[model samples]
Each structure stands twice: as C-alpha cells, then as structure tokens.
Target: MNAWIGTLIALCALALSAATAYVQHRARKRETLGADVTAYFHRTSDFARIKLFDGTVRQAGYHLVIWNHGPAPAERVHLAVADVEGAAVELADCPPDEFPLQRLDKGARYPVPWIPVSDTHRGARRFTVHLRWQDGNGTQERLLPMRRGQTNV
Candidate 1:
C-alpha cells in the first residue's frame, strides 16, 4: 500500500509539471508574436512599367510588401516618404488610395506601389519611409530604409 501511494504521488507530480510546461510554452509563443511588422521591397516581379512623355523627366516602377506578423492586429497603418538620397526619385508621390488601412490583421500582407522619377536608376537607392500604426499599446512608428531587392526593408 505504501509503495502504491508513493507511485501515485509521483505520477500526480509529473502530470502537474507537464501541465505547467505546456502553459509556459504557449505563453512564450504569445510573447514572441506580440506585435511585429516588416516590409519587403519587390523589384521586378510586379511587372510595373512606366513610359514618360517628357524626355527630361522619366520614371521607374516597383512595389513593396508590408507585412504584420504579430499576434494582434495593427490599425490605421500609414506610410509616407521620409527622405531620399543617392537617387533621383519623386518626393511627393501620392500614396495609393489605401493610404490609411482600416485594419491589418495578424500575419497580413499589404502591397504598395512605388514609382521613382528616374529611368536609369543608377547608383544607390537610399530612400526612407515612415510607417505608423496603432495597436494595443498605442501609436507605433517605424522607419523603413529602402533597398534594391528583397533586402531588409
């Protein structure tokens, strides 16, 4: 009887430990995805074309993929050009009709168009965009440095 009681006690302790570990794992996953966001610069896959009527002023086209990989959704997401350098790009290009997204659910992807005012597009493409959004905490902002291909946008 004593041995059986000891075995039962050990099993109960093991079960409790497993339950605690499972709960902790779930919490860790939730913490990891608190509110993360990223953007990727899509170069040519978009097949965006631009033809300029004026010889002096030219343009090139590209797109960006903004993604929210967080567990919670981001609201009122807005993107705007912050700065441009080493490139002859348009500074006041109007944003897409979807200026401020109503809501970007978790793990959602959004695409935005980019048309630079340069045809050759030589030299470095150092442009920065400011991103703003609202989440559980409050308003959040990020600066996205543009690059050529699938770089860290």
Candidate 2:
C-alpha cells in the first residue's frame, strides 16, 4: 500500500513538471516570435484638413495610429473599432493606399489616416481598437481601450 501511494505521488509530480515546462516554452516562443501591435487614438494640434463623408473637408486634430511593440514583425495588419461604453464609431474617408497595411516592422509606427464617423457620437467617447496581425507564430490580436481627444489611448 505504501509503494502504491508513493507511485501515485511521483506521477503527480511528474505531471506538474511537464505542465510547467510546457507553459514556459509557450511563453518564450510567443515572446520571441510573436508580433504585438497596438492602436490608439492620438490627439494632435495640427488641425489638418480631413474630408468628411459628405465631401466636406473639416479641420480635426484627432486620428488613429498603429505601432508594433514586439520583437517580431507584423504582417497583414487590420483594424476594427468597437464602442465599449459610448456610441459606436466607424472609420471613413481613409486614403486609398493606407489601409490593410502589408507589413510593419518591430518598433515601427504607422499613421492611420482614418476619421471616426457616427451620427450620435459626442462628449467623452469610449471605444476599443482591435488590432490583428500575422507573425511567425500565428495570427495575433490585441484590443486597446481608447478615449477621444486624448493621446494616451
């Protein structure tokens, strides 16, 4: 009976060891080979002319920017917006060749020339920017909480 008990305990210890090793390996792999991209709403003072949906150019100082903060490069970057606490928003009037970016290297920043459009969006906006990209490991994604008219989204 004592021998059986000892065998059971040994088995549990071995299983735990294997599980820990597996977790560590996965973490290392992702850290070294995965792409971590982030998107945020940026507030600027340029007040650049941005064309509205109705072909009317307006001066706005807010925009979106994408950055890859990982060791690996990101490919096929895509963006999606979701309203977390306030009105939903959609990007409109983007340049023709600026979207669906093909590649972005690590530590690189890309200006996302997009304007937010919504019928009922006003006053203290809360949203989420979904960034999806492909790396050596697989397709990785991240969600960034954002607020309008702020640079630290």
Candidate 3:
C-alpha cells in the first residue's frame, strides 16, 4: 500500500474508534439511569403532600416519588424533571451515586421534590421526569397529571 494511503487509513481508524467510544459512553450513561416518566403520580410526595404552583412563580416547584422495585441495589440514580407545558423548564438533575435508594428495600417508595428555577417553567401544561440510576439497573419512571387544589404538600 502507498505510504500516504496507509496514513489515511490509520486516521480513519482513529476517528472511528473515537466515535465508537463516545457512543458507548452515552449508552452506558443512559443505562445507569432507568427510564423517564412523564405520565402520572408526580404531584404527590411520600408524605402525601402535593406541591404545585397556582400559575404563579411558586408553582414552578414540583414534588415526585422514586420507588425501588428491584431486588438488587442501585448505585447511582439521577432524576431529570421538566414541566410538560412549560418550554425550557428547568428540571432537577440528581446523580445519586453511592447513595441509591437502597432504603426503599425492595418494593419500597421514595419521594423526591424538585423546583424549577429557570424561565423554562412558564405555562407548562405537562412535565417529563427522567430517572437515571447507577450501573444502568433498577431504572423506572411514572407520569401523572398535574393536580390542582388542596395538595397535602
């Protein structure tokens, strides 16, 4: 093979390797986190307190629950929450590494609350909550309607 051609091939190989690594890293990162919940059961807290804003700035705050239904312990759990209606709503990003919800103790429930800080929470009709956990195991999510009225929270 020509010297120049060999060099070109080597460069292409390097680029391919880099791309592969990046893809793998992202896949692993996603796996460590279980799934995203943008449906039901988001307004209620473990204590049965519901956190919601009455179209005011305070409404930007939201409370959610995280339950561990798996038998094995999860290492790190990250939750990304967003308001469905509010464009660019800021969701809480949590990396619970070395602090997975082991306390749930198999089929136990854990409630977590998050506040929207950015303008992305304006006029939000629905919300999307993403839960990422460690080693990519024990990842699940739930999506619930936004409830108004007297919430326990």
Candidate 4:
C-alpha cells in the first residue's frame, strides 16, 4: 500500500510538470507572434513637375516611404517627418501632417507625398520618420532616422 501511494504521487507530480511546461511553451509562442511585426521606412527620390510662384518647375524630390516586411499586416498606421538637426525645412509640396493609413499589408510599400527640399534645407542630410501602427497583438511605435545615402526597411 505504501509503494502504491508513492507511485501515484510521483505520477501526479510528473503530470503537473508536463502541464506547466506546455503552458510556458504556449506563452513563448504568443510572445513570438507579437514580436513578428517588424517594419521600417526608407528614403526614395523621383522627378516631377511642381508649381512655384513663378511657374512650373521640374525637379527631383525625396519621399519618405514605409515598407512592411513582416508576415503580419499593420493597421491604423500613422507617420510624421522631421529634420534630424532641428533645422527649418520647407516642402515644395506638403504632405498631410498626419497620415491615416488604415492598413498596410505585408510586403507593401506606402510613400508619403513628395517633398522637394528648398535651398534653406540643403544642409540637412538626415531626417526622422515616426511611425505607429497596430498588429495582431497591440499598438507599436518606432522612430527611425533616414540618411541621404542609407535606407532601412
């Protein structure tokens, strides 16, 4: 009788250990899924005709673009741009102060409006792009610095 009771207690302890390990595994999986939604923005340029006080001028303007590289989709996305040096910058064509991107799917790219740098901002070489979005887990925010020659996505 003593041996049977000891065996039963040992079995219960083993079962409890297995159950605890399974719960921990599931928690780790959930954390991994939440961390999978990584995204970033990059700098790109294109030429277009923009209107000025004098007339229309064809010029190359830079655009800040965000590309979703993760497997999950980003929702309720927003973006803002600012010069890294805190210098005054002018945009030939201004984008909205805040973007209301409803959804950005995986492998998708979203470009802000083209901003032609004026002579005053010529010395600025780096800019910060602030991005916020929601994934399957919750909301996330990132501030990325983009340089003239470097790109991140």
Candidate 5:
C-alpha cells in the first residue's frame, strides 16, 4: 500500500475509536443518573378539597412528593422545578433523604413542596410540572402536568 494511503487509514481508525469512546462515556453517565433518580408527583395531596395556603408569588402553595425508587438509599438527589416551557424556578432542597411513605419502596411517595411561584398560573387553564434531577451517573428530567382545581367562582 502507498505510504499516504496507509496514513489515511490510520487516521480514520483513530477517529472511529474516539467517537466510540465518547458515545460510551455518554451512555455511562445516563445510566448513573437513572439509578439515583426517584419518581416525582405533580401534586402531593390526593384529588380532594383542601385549603390552599399563600405561596411565594400568587398561587396556592401545596406540598408535592418525590419518591425514591432506587433499590438502595440515595443521598443528595439533586432536584429542580420548572414551568411547562422548561423555565426553572427556585425550590426547597432537602439534603437529607426523607421518605414520607414507609420503607421507601419502589413506588413509595415522598412529599416535596412545589409552590407555583406565578399566581396567574393558579387559575391556569393548563400547566405542567418539570422535574430535573441527577444522582451520580448523569441527569434526567421528568415533565408532568399539574392537576387543575375546580372553581366555584
């Protein structure tokens, strides 16, 4: 084979190896993230009438739940809340992993306050909940719609 042709083949092989490594790295990261994350709820309380407390901006404040679904306990399960459009807002963070439900089973539920900072969203015709989190491997996000409340007025 010509020297130039041999060198070209070697360069192509190197490029392929680099690409494969990068892809593997990304997959590993995702797996790690999925392991640590738990399930989150759009609303904490069940579909029952309850008094709404004053929240930060104008919407009624209620406690939302984030359940740990991992087989083993997870610490520092990073969390973030956002609007339907993916705009993030400040939320209370708990370093200590607390499982409201007993045993922290796969489907167990935990309470986390997800106060809608925007009052206008209170009577919102429709809204969504965006959950962002990461455990150790990588990061994952969950989007769920906030259940609408009935209005007498």
Candidate 6:
C-alpha cells in the first residue's frame, strides 16, 4: 500500500509539470507569431526652385519613415498623425488617411513623402504617430511620439 501511494503522488507531480510546460510553450509561440513595426524620420531635403520666365520658390520638408522589424509580416497596416489642439504639422504626398498596406515584410523600410511643420508653430516640438496593423494574433495599435531630428520606433 505504501509503494502504491508513493507511485500515485509521483505521477500527479509529473502530470502537473507537463501541464505547466505546455502552457508556457503556447505563450512563447503566440509571442513569436506576431510582427513588430516601427517608425522614424529618414532625412530632410530642400526642394529645388525652378528657374523659368518668372522665378518661383518652393520649400522642402523632412521625410517620415516606417519600418517593420518583425519575425512575421504585418498585414493591413495603417498610419496616421495624431491631432493636437494647436499644432501646425501637415503631411505632404502622404498616403490616404485610412489606406491599407497589404503586407509589410520583415526588415522592410517605407519612406513617406514629407511632413512639413509650419514655422509659425514653434511650440510644436513633438507629435504622435499612430500605427495600426494586423498580425497572426490580431489587430494592434501603437502611439509613437516623434521628435524633430530624432527617430521614434
């Protein structure tokens, strides 16, 4: 009887250990199946002025960049700039406000055209970039704060 009781207890412990390990394995698998996307400012360039019969001046702005640093691809990706009460930041040559990206592969870089901030808004030093996407797990959203001359991911 003593030997039988010892064997039963050992079996229960083994079963509990196996259950715990399985749960941990599932958590790691779910984590690995998701994609990670990031955003940044690539660089700034000046717009060349055209010299025609009449001189015209054109100003240039900086480019905003989005990158996917993922183990999996991000699907149906969307990007937007968060609205502030009195900010004078504007996007130029940008994608539609609610456009979808079919897929963003891992390690891929996408540079948006330009985001020009009006010189009159000197207090607007930082803005938020709202990112949304779908992965294997589900839909996700991230609010990234971007500073001038700095990269935010």
The candidate that wins on lDDT is 2
lDDT score, candidate 4: 0.63
Better of 4 and 5 by lDDT: 4
Which 10 residues in a row give candidate 1 its minimum summed lDDT? 86-95
- lDDT (tens digit, per residue) of candidate 1 on 94-135: 435656888889999886656544444433356776778887
Worst 10 residues of 2 by lDDT: 114-123
lDDT of each prediction vs. the true structure?
Answer: 0.66, 0.76, 0.49, 0.63, 0.50, 0.69
Flag regions of model 5 displaced more than 4 Å.
1-36, 39-61, 90-109, 125-153
Off by over 4 Å in 3: 1-62, 83-105, 119-123, 135-153
lDDT (10s digit) by residue, model 4, range 97-122 = 44557888877886543444566454
* TM value for model 3: 0.38
Predicted candidate 3 versus true structure: per-residue lDDT over 47-146, tens digit per residue = 3333344443343234555666655444455445555553434533333352344333445555554454555553344566555554344444443345
Give candidates' CA RMSD values in order: 7.1, 5.0, 11.5, 5.5, 8.1, 5.6
Cα misplacement distance, residue 55 of candidate 5 (Å): 12
Instruction: List the candidate 4 regions with Cα displacement exceeding 4 Å.
Output: 1-58, 86-94, 113-119, 150-153
Which wins on TM-score, candidate 1 or candidate 2? 2
The sequence of per-residue lDDT tens digits that candidate 2 reaches over residues 1-153 is 999999999999999999999999999988989778988766776766776657888655676789898899999998777777534466665544555789999999987544665654433467788888899998888878887754332
Clash count per candidate: 0, 0, 25, 0, 3, 0
TM-score of 4: 0.61
Which stretches of candidate 2 lie above 4 Å from their native place? 1-29, 51-55, 85-88, 95-98, 122-124, 150-153
Give, for candidate 5, the lowest lDDT window spanning 10 residues: 93-102
- For TM-score, the strongest prediction is 6
Cα error, residue 142 of model 4, in Å, equals: 0.8
